[model samples]
Target chain A: MEHEKTQIERHTSKQFDVELEDVREQVLTMGGLVEQQIANGVKALIDGDSALGEDVARSDYKINTMEVAIDEACTKILARRQPQAGDLRLVLAIAKTITDLERIGDEAEKIGRMAVHLAGKDRPPSAFRQISQLGGHVRQMVRDSLDAFARMDTEAALAVAQHDAEVDREYEGVMRQCITFMMEDPRTIKHMLDVMWSVKALERIGDHATNISEYVVYLVGGRDVRHLSIEELEKEAARAISPRTGQ
Target chain B: MEHEKTQIERHTSKQFDVELEDVREQVLTMGGLVEQQIANGVKALIDGDSALGEDVARSDYKINTMEVAIDEACTKILARRQPQAGDLRLVLAIAKTITDLERIGDEAEKIGRMAVHLAGKDRPPSAFRQISQLGGHVRQMVRDSLDAFARMDTEAALAVAQHDAEVDREYEGVMRQCITFMMEDPRTIKHMLDVMWSVKALERIGDHATNISEYVVYLVGGRDVRHLSIEELEKEAARAISPRTGQ
Candidate 1:
């Protein structure tokens, strides 16, 4: 009787591990969706495509649904498995990650709307150039952060957070230029501001990526580098940025 | 033997409910911390106080630490109790909420940094006016969404989500103004964009709050509102959004 019970216990534990992987996999799947949303949202803006923006808006629901489903899965696992130690940490981090992905999706959708709005506008060369530059940095940050998340790489995550500060400096530059544009032609305020909103959305996306990196640190190393300097963390972080993947 | 078993089962179940409540309470505590972080971060920015921004920077770790702790708590309860149905949803939603709060905190911190950067500069009056408007909306959204959440009010959550569109509109206006500002005087691009970044931070805060409100709907009514009209969801979500303190 004791031997049989032990065998059943081992089987149950294995089953729990499989289920935990499923939850992680689902959260990762959702991460992919949110990442796509960010990219597509940015594309919609740059391409001046309202249809693309609308698609992004529609996809937000799927993102929201995935979030709910993943939350359910993690909760169910936690309740059933009573996982301790490392498993517990992994489950908790994924749960936190779903929330990050969902927000990232929203930012993407916001970008879509901005794209639709900006598609027809005539933009100043200098102002447009910097706006585009800020957007590019922000988008790269999102892609890298998501990669850090998938690879369970704290180093990549830290790099993503540090990258945000540079965007900040650029954003500062963009705003100064925008102000002059506004002063030059009050008529320009409407279009130029759309560019500004898009940059801001991208920056927030970067912040979410940083948050994901922080989660990576907690998941693997079990250390929270959130309050510390990215400079310090980067000193020890993987020197490479999270691979841009398809580039 | 049967009587003893029955008594033990009832005792254990009650214990589970209490622990679940503990998880819910902790999630709230985390939310409160992040919310305060955003407020302080924004205030730090507005006042040009590096100290306040530094304070936000300092608080990031604690927020992250608390996130892990609460996530652990949820996983622990789920593992040990194996809560079904409603209890499971509570654990999961609270877990998701931790993430949203952390993002909100990060956005606030970014705003604080921008505030510090802009402290030394002369900002456009119109830009400041719009920034204040966006800030107020975001701040209100955060406060009321949490209130709706604490109360499990779906209507409140829907209301918050609806308000997000308004913030978007404001963001659009700010962007237009900034772009115009930069065109006329390239020299002001940096300062104008700092203010714009701060506005963007506030707008993202509102987005996070809206996310919190959506989760509130799922938790309270178990309904999925991802694809529905706001009007439909608002009407159907009464049970979810209604303050259910008595219930």
Candidate 2:
């Protein structure tokens, strides 16, 4: 009877592991879709494709639905498996991650909506170039952050956080340029605001990407690294990866 | 022996309830601090009080620490008690709510930082009044959302969510007015941008508060009302509060 009980426990554990993997896969799938949404959303803006922008806005419903589904999955797993230690941390991190990802989708939709509004507006050529640069950087961060999460690569995650500062710099530069444009010609103010809001959305997308990276670090390292410097995060990552290290 | 086991189980359950309540109280305390921070941050901006702005920014560290502490408490309870059904839902909602609260703090800090930047910058006189009004509306939403959480009042939560639309409208009006100010005279561009960013932060604070309200509704109703229409949310809330009544 003891042996039978042991077998039952092992079977339950294996089932829990499968469920955990399912949750992880669902998150990755959502991340992938969001990445495309952001890339297309920004591209639509730079290229002045209102139809594509509308598509990005409409597709958001799908992401929201997926978020709810993933959230339910996490809650179910937490209740059924009663995950402890690392398992509990993984579930918690995944749950938090999907929330960020969902918000990223919302931000992207905002960008898309802005794009739709700006599609027919005549704007300075420099505006599109600046947006393209900022959007490209943020989109790369999103893609790489998702990669870091999938691989559970703490180093990659830390690198994403560091990249955020560069995005911030570019964002500020765009804002300054927009201000200059607005001041140079009163007629440019409205369009400049649109450009400004798009870049702001891009900047927020970078922040969300950084958030995802932080969650990756937490999940793999079992340490909360938020509000910590990159240097501190690096040291924590090293310590987490090698518990025997005295650092 | 069985009787002794039952008594021990009852004791453990009681202890768990205490721990859960402790987590709830900590979250409420954090929420209250964040609400104050938002008010102070915006007031500092409107009043041009750089010292107050700096204080608000510095105090964010305390909120951050409290957030981590509450998060740890939630995780500990989850792992130890493996609460089911309503208890588990409450813990999950509390965890999510604290994250939103922390972010609301961050938004307030952003506004505070902007306030510091705009300390002596001259802008149109109306900017401050508009900002104060927007800030007041958002702050009230934050307070009401917290009250809704404490009482598990879905009706109050729904009201907060409804108020967000008003906040959004005010935010757009501010943005438009700021654009007009910048357009009329090039000299006001820089300071107007500061005002725009501050109001943007306020808008996001409203969004976070709405998120909290949605969580409250979810906790009490056991249904995900996210992405639903206000009418639909009201219907769901009613159905949730009285499960036997058919919607």
Candidate 3:
């Protein structure tokens, strides 16, 4: 009878572990969708393709629905499993991560809107170099941040945080170049405005990705590095980002 | 024995209601703090109070913490109670509403950042009328949206959605004004750019507030009215706003 009771306990505990795994799988799935959306949205902007932008916009609704469904699923697990301490934190982190994912989807839609707006306008006479450079930086930030999340690399997350300041600097540069174009030729204001909006969206996407990276840091290290300076943050990031040699 | 079981169930069910009431109370408490932050952020902007703006920015961390706590509390209630149907929706809506509230807090901080950036410059030379109008409209939306949630007034929620168009229009107007300001006076360009950022933040807060209203409407009506027309939205808003005086 004691052996049977132990067997039942093991089965229930295994089931609880399975639920946590399920929650993680959902998060990674949603993360993949968001990553794809970011890539597609930026490509839409670069290629001047409204059709691709339309696709990105359509997928945002799925992210919204997924967030609701995932929240429900988590609540069910919490109710049935009655996870305490660390298990509870893991569930809470997943819930928070979904919110970040959904916001990333929203940022992608904003980029899509800009792409749709810019569909009719030609790139300005000479500001493409600066805009393209800024785009490159933003794309890199998004990529690195997501990679950090997937690998649970705190260093990468800290780098992502540092990258944001540079992205902001680049955005400021783009704004200045666009301002120059508008001042030089009034007709370009419309297109330049759209470009500025797209740049803003990319910057926001970078911010959200950094947020995901921050969450990974928190999950791994159990510390809040949100408001820390780049140098101090780098140590935590390094510790988190470095892969262990063995299990 | 069955009758004793029935009485116990009734007692627990009442306790469940009490728990739900606690969650709702905390949600509103958090919402009230967020609304005040938005108000203070904008007041900092209008009054050129950079210190106040900094205060708003610093306090955003507290808002984020409050949000996580509220979310955990709501999920715990949902899980422990295993609420069905309407109770489920109410809990879910509260969960969703907290996300909107957190985003609103972010928007408020964005406004504060813009305020600090614009502080070095003199007052807007471009009338600044639309931004002020939009600020008021969005503030009212935040205030009344929370009221609708507290009262479960679908009519008030609908009205909030209808007024989103006003916010959008104001955003467009700000866009144009900033573009023209850049074109007409290159000197005011930097300040106008910051002003546009402030207006953008306000526009988004209005959007989030409208989303909360939509949730309230859906929570009560159990229908998706996202694509509904402005006129129909206003009718629903009227009901939520007026509360008990419909006769």
Q: Identify the candidate with maximal DockQ.
A: 2
- Find the candidate with the highest lDDT and give its number: 2
Clashes of 3: 10
Candidate 2 structure quality by residue, lDDT tens digits, A84-196: 99899999999899999999999999989998999998867786788898898898999899899889888889889999999999998888888888888878788878888
What DockQ does each candidate score versus the true complex, computed on alpha carbons?
0.33, 0.84, 0.23
Q: Kindly report which residue pairs in candidate 3 clash with one another.
A: A154-A237, A154-A240, A154-A241, A155-A237, B155-B236, B155-B237, B155-B240, B156-B240, B156-B241, B159-B237
Give the per-residue Cα lDDT of candidate 3 at B12.
Answer: 95
- lDDT per residue (tens digit) for residues B1-247 in model 2: 9999999999999999899888889988999899999999988898789999999999999899998898889999999999999899999999899989999999999999998999898856786788899999999999999999999999899999999999999898888888878778778888888888889989999999999999999998888888888889888778767754454
Runs off by more than 4 Å, candidate 3: A125-130, A136-156, A222-247, B1-26, B47-65, B68-96, B119-126, B214-247
Model 2 alpha-carbon drift over 4 Å, by segment: A243-247, B243-247
Docking quality band of candidate 1, CAPRI definitions: acceptable
lDDT of 1: 0.75
Model 3, residue A101: distance off in Å is 1.9
For model 1, the superposed segments whose C-alpha errors exceed 4 Å read A1-62, A79-82, A123-189, A231-247, B1-68, B114-138, B155-159, B162-192, B224-228, B239-247
RMSD of 1: 5.8
